[model samples]
Target: MSRAEETADTAAAWIIRRENGDWSDEDQAALDAWLAASDGNKAAYWRLKHSWKEADRIGALGIAAVPTAPRKALARYGMPVALAASLVAAFWIGAIPFLSEPSAPKLVASTYKAGIGERKDVALADGSHVELNTRSVIRAASTSGHRDIWLDEGEAYFEVKHDPRRPFVVHAGARTVTVLGTKFSVRRDGGDVSVSVLEGRVRIDENPAKDGRPASTTTITGGMSAISEGRSTLVTQRSEERVESALAWRDGMLSFDRTTLADAAAEFNRYHRRPVIVTDPGAAGIRIGGTFQASNVEAFARLLRDAYGLHVEIAPDAIKISSQGVTAL
Candidate 1:
């Protein structure tokens, strides 16, 4: 295949992967290689992908083709109405009796959803990466002019490409994280929203829903984390190690250091069909630190017991962790 053709095919393959919502490391590597090879390759790939999307929209309306209009209005055999009908029919090559034009939402304004206990990786038009965690729903609007991923609900880790002109924005609650380039996780559990920075820098702010409105912008540096409570942005030292622990579900490993028994139990409970019951808030505050397999919930519970000197009560539906008459402190 010619260089242009090869690039187009690569883009097509990536498009298929995206349509399937199965973006893998292999596709990422190909995209990186394509970009490094030549600027022309990127341009050609984008052009074809853009065209393909338009074609998809057309096909969705049950149309095989939309014909071009003739230059200027012209009388054809003194039969103006017939010519108009033919033009309309040509423009809309679909099933007859095409009822009221469906108010189809824009593709990106639309969303791809994942249920609980599910994780999916998707590649956007601008070559950015997003890993949607369990019970997460995200919408991606990918155009050459702009790229956006809006996390409507649940959690997602984003790796946005560097583009000064087109800042990648992730909207989760009132916390809108804007980035030119970075890797970060934005999670909304209930009414609380947390922004954890993994790489590069991100501006976490309260962007306005309407134009001409003021915003509350807070810049959280790398290794730092913030949570939203009410109208203010609260900043605190996000245990770099613990931040990794919070997202360990993505890696199939649960890592924790200096975390509380209560918080740790909560994390594990998300995966458990039964709750990790905590009776006392005091007991839950015991210090904990360790790395363990996330798949084995019982093992993790034992690790907590052995480390924190807490008593573990195993129940059919849940496990309860409480004080052993002493604290780990």
Candidate 2:
């Protein structure tokens, strides 16, 4: 394949991967990097995406193939409505009556998104405040006496104003968190959502499957956390100090209490473009703890080299970490 064709195929693969499954933080980061690499990649991906959606609608409407000059007419008709007319003229007229437009979503929510290494503080019209973490997206709207937020990806801290008439609900993946007036932080990674309450109380509802069965709900008070992933939901209580530690990012710091090197690398990668890749399993599992600026990956790498006798290789694309003897590829 030509270079352009190869890039187009790569873009198409990324689009397919995102559409077929839950895209995690790593996938998002890689996609962001690929898009940033070239403008042609972005155009090709979007074109393929639009084509796929159009193909889905055409297939669903059962638009059969046209014969002879009708095929030429069908090709000439560019718009969907014109194509529908051509298909109807070629086939049975009653088939057109069976086609219906796709149903629109019930809520018309406003979306707020934060780019990589960027944090956003958004104030809702309803007196609620939200602090969106890097590379996060949330859709919020108030209707039918309910204030709902859908955390599509990444983390957000919410400070909800008291309103008994309007219950605040946050839908993240398979879990839903309901609060009245509370300060809470929610982190969504892939199919999991971690909720940490700082003030007041909130109830979390979890649905393991989409079978319409009753969802399990649990109430979490201040200094409590709940993690919902797939079929399991775990709730735990943390000390006030720990709760403060978890919210350290609000103050432009990342506090890690004996965090694994691999985990620490992942955390730091969330804030910056150059990923810290730990090559060796032993080096990756090494525990380190301290408060550090989220953007200072070089300092973190230096710390690993000086304190733990690890090898740090600074490359153009990534910061590779490994043991002293292990060679970094």
Candidate 3:
């Protein structure tokens, strides 16, 4: 097939996925790649997308008109859009709209994806250790003088061997995290992306050239972490060992050093089916500290219940948490 045909096919697939509201990471990446390949591709995709959204609006209007026979004419207009959207992507997982467009043309672009409940480790040519966790995708290549990886989604732990000339940079949405030689994990969870350092130090900054945002910076040392909305963190310069508690899950152990119960429970949810949901927002910041073996996170809940007098109730599809005893703030 011609490149345009292949591109159109890919775009059509993406449109169908989004219209169905079941767009997956794979489909979204394909659409992003197609857009970055040429402005023409983006224009085509957006054109279809606009048409589809308009169709959805029409469908909603038609649904409202069903009770009002006087509004039946709007129903016909809605049918075409509904049909197009059905062929587009209205029922599948919604397409993520955060893909980045490149600044200039390039010869080749790479793609990487990880499945659910999966873990992978790799040693780069420069002696860097890359550990990719479940359901993550990242792509990287060196073109000019810089080395970088675009993390489409999920988390990755990187132990970058020192290279002064070619510093390692990780790209997640609008953020670009840089490291000379260090051990760190970058996790892109929904809108809250986090970076935790285990060894050496790394710099976190915005990529203005890509997103045109003012540059903000942070330096994370071993056992330190920073979290941001999308990519801006309200917290930073934390203790390094504390960051270890969060990263220890990769090693099959859970560690906590003066972390709050709410934070610990959130970590537990990462590995549990029924996530721990804090009923009381006040409990989210309660102070707690200790080293507990990384086994079933349920054990941690029981420990809290027994020792701290907290109420633990397990629902059919979820775990609910609430304070039982009067506790000091």
Candidate 4:
């Protein structure tokens, strides 16, 4: 078989395995690495995945079905022979055409989002990388000479490819962050925005003035952060450890250093539909420190119960915590 055919088959195998209900983070990482290896691989995977979804819909509609063959005869890498045959047939029949080198690069508008308890990695057409945090959304668009991103909500870490001709700009809340090439994260909570730079530099410009006051611009480099609240923007230098802790969500963990129980609960709530609520002011004021799995609300609650001698009431809708002997409401 040709190299293209081999790649297509591998892509199909990946799609089937992903839908098998046991896909893990390691499997996702492997798939991401494969897709990032080449544009052809990424295109092939997306195209085939789209076709597979269409095939599923058609099957659900009771349409004429693709012929089934014995698994041993055509199965490749555990893929169902009928499905594999359908994919190949689709390519040949022009339902999903085989990809070829384009005459010119196409700039496609795309949106990347992650639901609660989920994270997503997006490889952009320009070689940049974006990792969306839980409950986050971002819209990305590119033109021949420019690239733009709007952080509609939540947070995302960006590894931008250096392109002098195409300025990469991210709009979040009332601020705009521009970078030629850099590694950074932008988070939006309502009208507030925060930017943390891990490498290189970025420029943050406040949006046009609405109160007849002049807007401001700030430039921050590696190990620095900028926060905007209302009309004020504050830039501060951060320790390397603090920077790493801030980005821990990308690794599915939450790192807290002397973080308050209330604040920690808020952080955990972003990844869980069921919230962790500290019932009393005393428990809310209690400071704790650790790195915990973001999705493991039960584990964190257990820690509060065991280590802090706190009362933990685990209901179907929420986890309530308070000082020992204090009933959680």
Candidate 5:
């Protein structure tokens, strides 16, 4: 009923879920966040986990443990009440080591972030590599059973190491990308998520009951892309050129093949502080094609002036483009 008892009860529940053998990456991430919240939570979880292991050992030896009442209560409640009781008893008698002397090294989640116009490279413990794009954030951790990554914001490219025994999963928004080994990228824009595979294959799963629709899973191979918005997902095949263009940001370049000025501006704004604003509908509708440096907005604006003959207004916070009384160069 008290805080300590509640913490112990939660810890016991986690142990049961873990031993059930169906524990997921999301579940492990939630447990890690809980343990990192406070020292009391860590102590409670480790104490209960240690005691549960001991209980399993004794049961394997056909020994009659003293916590008979808690064992009988497990059948009715479906929880490890015996382990909880044993943990409490051990604490009272100083029989079990606490957080100061954990049985094994704790696996803490690692977080990586990239600022505006900055890219970061991370080499994971399992030989996996991650490249975070500008203004992106990700959290990763690897256990003996699986590797998990949570894309908190923006975009990231993943070069996953091949390990069939340990599945690699990336959680972005309401969708999950699962794979054994692959080269892919995940981009999160508000409620929409996109997955593009360059090599190998990966499976994308949408969360259940989103927008009143049942969940769905789509497997995409190399040169394939999946875009999920709300509960609807569209998987389409991409040509090699399209795939390269989509991933051009990794090389600090933005590639566009007849992309609209409005759309192109949106993509470039992701990496720069000053935005490109097309005030004229005609200018916004103009289609352009080329590759440009992602961080160089001034050059892009100059191109509109010299090549397109559009009126370019440069302000302190933004670059405004208009097609008023303008003729093609």
Candidate 6:
């Protein structure tokens, strides 16, 4: 089929989904992204919507020759005005009224940062709560129009209150997460950002460029994760156990489930000034699993030396691990 046809079909599907009475915040954000992608997309969506409404009106008058199920039913019994109102409400999910009062949204922005080995809990003006992990930085903003945050470093967990008038958004690395009300977390380590949803749903999209639109979009609900690096984002289903492990840092603990030695050390180093260096690729590949306090780097190193028989070298600023038979420091 042609590109225009495909766009119209997709828009029509969205309209139907909204009419099903279960349309969510994620769906509305998706609709906004679709509209912003291209002017052609907006035209196509409106074209199909107008045509659908016209067809229903003609069927109500028993004038259309269409034999479709909805059209046939409408021909036998006229469409109700209440149904038309409902259709209008459903299809207008993300649309702005042209004739409404012309006003701009008042934007409010603030920045918050946490130090190494320090955790901070923040309560916003909108009743939303944010917990910042060690060495994390975030900016929270709320206005009469919207609410959003920028995760500049490290990780944070959010417990957001329900407010359809204001969406809670997080900008991390190259991605943006939009939600109405949900329990979720966002972790940004350099160029990689991971988003985990614990309750409700959120829409993840590439950050729009200046005077440009988003590059990609996806929706993730509870027990789901979206990982973004560079220009790509991948969504995956996660077990409850894994989700809990991801959020365990809020409790001053780091939980690993069959995580690699290299990865486990990386988590440990996040909370401390000292770094962990893996010298042997073979030892780095060894999988270790357990729960440890975020500050218990010594115990973790001991476990690696005694249980795994890997060499451990300690320095004032860094710790080195290897598989070769070197004496443990």
- Candidate with the greatest TM-score versus the true structure: 5
lDDT of 1 at 329: 34
Error of 2 at 105 (Å): 13
Off by over 4 Å in 5: 4-107, 210-213, 327-329
- Please report how far candidate 4 places residue 43 from its true position, in Å: 30
Count of backbone collisions in candidate 3: 25
Which runs in model 6 stand beyond 4 Å of their true positions?
Answer: 1-106, 209-214, 326-329
What TM-score should be assigned to candidate 1? 0.58
Question: How big is the RMSD of model 4?
Answer: 14.4
lDDT of 3: 0.64
Q: Residues 9-61, candidate 1, lDDT per residue (tens digit)?
A: 45445544544545544555566455445545555445444454254454444
Estimate, for each residue in 1-329, the C-alpha lDDT of model 5 and write its tens digit. Answer: 55665676566567666655565557866886787676678777776655654664444544444333323333334555544455444432333344446664555678899999999999999999999999998988788998989897899999999999999999898799999999999999877899999999999998654134568899999998889997788887666677787799999999999999999999888888988999978899999999999988989999988888999989999999999778653
**Clash number by candidate, in order:** 0, 0, 25, 0, 0, 0
* TM-score list, all predictions: 0.58, 0.67, 0.58, 0.65, 0.70, 0.64
Which of the two candidates, 3 or 5, achieves a greater lDDT against the reference? 5
lDDT of candidate 3 over 1-329, digit per residue (tens): 44544444455555555545454556656666766676556644655555554556555544321222212222333424345433233211122231234454342445566565456776655567788876677775654456778788888888887778887889876577998888888988764678888888888886443234467887777867888674456555567566876687587676776788788887666555667887786667767777665546567777777776777887678777787564743
| lDDT value for model 1 | 0.65
- Report, for every candidate in turn, its global Cα lDDT versus the true structure: 0.65, 0.75, 0.64, 0.79, 0.79, 0.73
lDDT of 6 by residue, 1-329 (tens): 55644554466566555545565545655775676566557654664465554544544554423213322222234445445333333333223342132563323356788998889999989999999999998877777768879787889999999999988889876688899999999998876889888888999888654334547888988888878887788887766676787889988999988899889888888889998889878888888888888887877787888997888888888888898874542
RMSD of each: 14.5, 10.4, 11.5, 14.4, 8.7, 13.4
Superposed Cα deviation of residue 286, candidate 1 (Å):
2.2
Query: For model 6, which pairs clash?
Result: none
Cα deviation of 7, candidate 6, in Å? 40
